[model samples]
Target: MSEIKDIAKFHIFSSAYFASAVNKNQYVTDGRKEIAFIGRSNVGKSSLINSLCGRRKLAYVSREPGKTRTINYYAIQSRRTVDEVEQRQDWYLVDLPGYGFAKTSQENKDNWSAFIDEYMRKSPGLTMIGLLVDLRHPGLPIDKKAYDWLKTVAPDLLIIGTKGDKLSRNELHKNLAQLKKLFPTNHAPIAYSSLT
Candidate 1:
C-alpha cells in the first residue's frame, strides 16, 4: 500500500527496547525475525519508530542528526491475520545508524559505515529492509544508492516517503511518482506522515 499501514490490520500490541549492539557478539542471538529501518541522518528514523509503535517517546528524538551510533533492537509482538486466523507475531525492530550528512568526524563516519555494513551483511534474522526517503527530495544520490544496495541483499522491501504532511495531496502524488522513477517497485512508495 502507498499509504501508512492500517493500525487495525497491522499494529504493534507490545514493543520494548531489547538490546543495543555495537558488534556481532552483542547482538541478540534469539531466533526472531528482524525488520530494519535505514535512511539519511536527521531523516527521522527514531521518530518514525516511535510513531509506528504508537508511543511518543519509545525512541529518543534528537535535534542533532546521527545521534544513533549503535544498532538498537526492540522486541515487538504485533497483531496480524493470515488467511482466516488472527495471530500474534513476535519480531525485532532494528534501528540502524543513519548514513549520510551528520555532525560527526570523518573517522567516526567511516567506522559507522563498516559497523552498519557488518550487521546488514551478517544478520540472519533480517527478514526485510525498510528504506525511508524524504518525499520532497526524491533525487538524493545517497538514498538511491542505499536502495540499490539493500534490494540486492533483502528481497522483501518496503519503500517509504517521509514528511507527507508537509506537502499537499496533489504534491504528494507528484513526488511519489518521481520517486518511483529512481526507486522502482511493484507498488508505489508509501507516503508516510508520522504525525498522522
Candidate 2:
C-alpha cells in the first residue's frame, strides 16, 4: 500500500462564507474544480480536511456528531506560469455534513439531504467526492448507502479510511481487507492519519 503522503498534494487557500442559514443563495460562484469531503458522523472528516490543508482549524472540528450542517466551499488557488504571465486556477474543498446520526431532528436531516443531493448533482465545478470512513470500524448500513448514493451521483469518487495512527501494521491491513471484502466496489480506499 502506497502512503497517503505520496498521493494527496493538498493546500488550504482560504475559507469562504458562501452561505449560512441566513442566506442559502450566497454559495460560492467562482468557477472552480471541487472535491467534496464526506463521512458518517464523528468520522473525523473535518480533522482530515484540516490536516490535508496543513491547518489546525481550517474546518470546524466538534465532538458532537453531525457538527457540519452546510456545504462548505474552500477556495484553492494555484499559480501557473505561462508566457511570462502568472495564471491562477481555482478549485474548492467542499465539506458536507456527516450522516447516520440518530439524534438529529427530522427537519435537519431532510434539509441536509436536500442540500447534499442538490450540490452533488448540480454543482458544475464538482470534480470528485471523497468518502471517508473510520479505520477502526467496518462499514455500516449508512456507510454503504452513502457510498452507493455518491457512486450514483458523482462521476469520480475517492474512498478514504481515517485514523491510521491508531492501528498497528497488521491491524491496518486486516481492517483494510475487511473493507475491501465488504464494499467490493471499484473505488480505492486509502489510509489517512489526520494527526500526521
Candidate 3:
C-alpha cells in the first residue's frame, strides 16, 4: 500500500480540482486534454479519482451513490526528468455524473443523459473515456449499453474493473475473463483496487 501511495505521490507534480458543471456553458474549455471517468452510480468512480490523484480526499467519496450531481474536473500534471531537464504533461480528469441511479425521477435521468451526451459530443479536448465497472459483477446490461455508446463517441475507450481486492485471485481471474468477452477491447480490463 505504501509503495502504491509513494508512486502516486511522486509521479504527479500537481493534481487539483478545476471545475464543476451542471450546464454546458460552465465546462472548462481551455484546450487541455481530458480523460473522462464514467460508470454507474456505485461503481467507485470517486474513489478511483482520489487514488489516481494520490490524494485520499481529492474527490468527495460517499458510500451512497449518486452524490455527485455535477460533472467535476480535476487538472493534473505529471513531471518527468530527462537529460537534466524537466518535462510535464498537463491534462484534466473529468468525472462525469454516474448513471443508473433509480432514486432519481425520470425527468432528472433524462436531463443527465442529455447533458452527458452533449459533453461527450462537444468537448474538443476529450481524448479518451475511461469506463469503470465493479469487478465483482462485470457487464451488467446497463454497463454494456454505456460501453457501446461510449465506443461511438470516444475514439479510445478504456474499461477498468474496480474493487479488485474484494475478489479472490481465482475469482478475479474469472471475472477478468468475463470482462474480456463483454467489452470490445484489444486487452482485458485491468482490475483496480484503491487500497492496493
Relative to the true structure, candidate 2 has a C-alpha RMSD (angstroms) of: 4.2
Reference-based TM-score, model 2 = 0.82
Best by TM-score: 3
Off by over 4 Å in 3: 1-10
Candidate 1: tens digits of C-alpha lDDT, residues 1-196: 3222333366688999988999889877689888889999878889899998988888888988888889999888888887988987788899999999656789998998888877878888876677889887878999988888877775467788998888889989999988888888655677788998
Per-candidate RMSD vs. true structure? 3.0, 4.2, 4.5
Q: Per-residue error at 25 for model 2, in Å?
A: 3.3
Deviation of model 2 at 120, angstroms: 0.7
Candidate 2 local lDDT, 81-185, one digit each (tens)? 557876655577788888987797899788788888877787777777888888888667788888888878975777788887899999999888877776655
Pairwise TM-score winner, candidates 2 and 3 = 3
TM per candidate comes to: 0.89, 0.82, 0.91
lDDT of 3 by residue, 1-196 (tens): 1222222333676799988999989988899878888999989999999998889999999988889899999998887776888777788889999999999899999999999999999988887788899999896999999998998887577788999999999999999989888996644477888998
Could you tell me which residue pairs clash in candidate 1? none
Candidate 1, position 172, lDDT: 93
Q: How close is candidate 3 to the true structure, as a TM-score?
A: 0.91
